[model samples]
Each structure stands twice: as structure tokens, then as C-alpha cells.
Target: MPQPTPDRDDQARLFREVVLVLGGVFAVQKTDDETIRRVAAGLERVYRRARQNQRSTTSSQALAPHPAIAGLLRITEAEGDEP
Candidate 1:
């Protein structure tokens, strides 16, 4: 006897549905305290490192003046006007 094979299209649809369900589970976990704690504990270091790099990049960009603004400042200073 031969075993029954699943339809390829049905298998693909099932895979998509599983991904969608997992996404929904994560979305729901965003507000659930127990799930949040479990996820945070598991990914705390990964999240912290990502956030740290993000903050550092944002702050450095914020602190650095744009090249056009710097050029304007230099022109004003050369003209003896305070920038």
C-alpha cells in the first residue's frame, strides 16, 4: 500500500497559515504579562544591544551638524557675522 501525499498547494497554504498564526500569537503576547516576561527574559541581551546601538547612532546623528549648515556657518563667520 502507498501512503497518501499532501497536495502541494494545500501544504503551502498551511505553511502560510502557520506563519500568520505565529505572528498573531506574538502580537497578542505584546500585551500579555506572562508572555512578555518569558520573551523578554529570553531576548533581553539581544534587545538591549540593538537598542543601545540604535540610541548611539541616533544621538551621534543628532549631534553632528549637516554639511550645508556647517558651510553656511563658515560663510557667516567669514563675513564677521555671528552664526
Candidate 2:
């Protein structure tokens, strides 16, 4: 099943949370443009790393087929049949 995508409200909420967290972490009461930019860069790095890890894990799992599928594959190979 296809997953539902986040709406603009969800995105806005996430942005607000990021800014709030960054401000708290940096000990700044107000978020400046430069600070927001820096925070955005850092967040992007973290997001990319997370996505990469997910992809790697998914690919590794895909490399290992179910036992039934593995058996069928083996049989097909033995019969010189293309799967």
C-alpha cells in the first residue's frame, strides 16, 4: 500500500520544531537567518544519513530471499529456465 505523504501543515510543524530545538540547543532566544541556514545544513546531513542507512538495510534484506523463493530459484536454475 502507498503511504500518505505529509501535508504542508506537517512540514510547517516539523520546521517549527527544528527551529525551536536548534534555538534551545544553541542557547539562542531568537533564530537568525544564518543560524537557521546552519541548522538546515546540519539537519539535511542527518536526514541524508538516515535515508542512506534505511536504503542500505532494505537492500541487504532484499539480497536474502525467503526459503521458498530460494528453493524455486534453485530449481529454475537447475532446469536452465529463466526466472
TM-scores for candidates 1 onward, in order:
0.29, 0.33
| lDDT per residue as tens, model 2, 1-83 | 85535654565576578667767866656657787788688777655565444433334344676897699779868886654
Cα error of candidate 2 at position 58, Å: 24
TM-score of 1: 0.29
For residues 1-83, write the lDDT of model 1, one tens digit per residue. 85535554554565467556755778876657686577556455444454344433334344665897699678868886544
How far is each candidate from the true structure, as Cα RMSD in Å?
22.4, 17.1
Model 2 TM-score relative to the real fold? 0.33
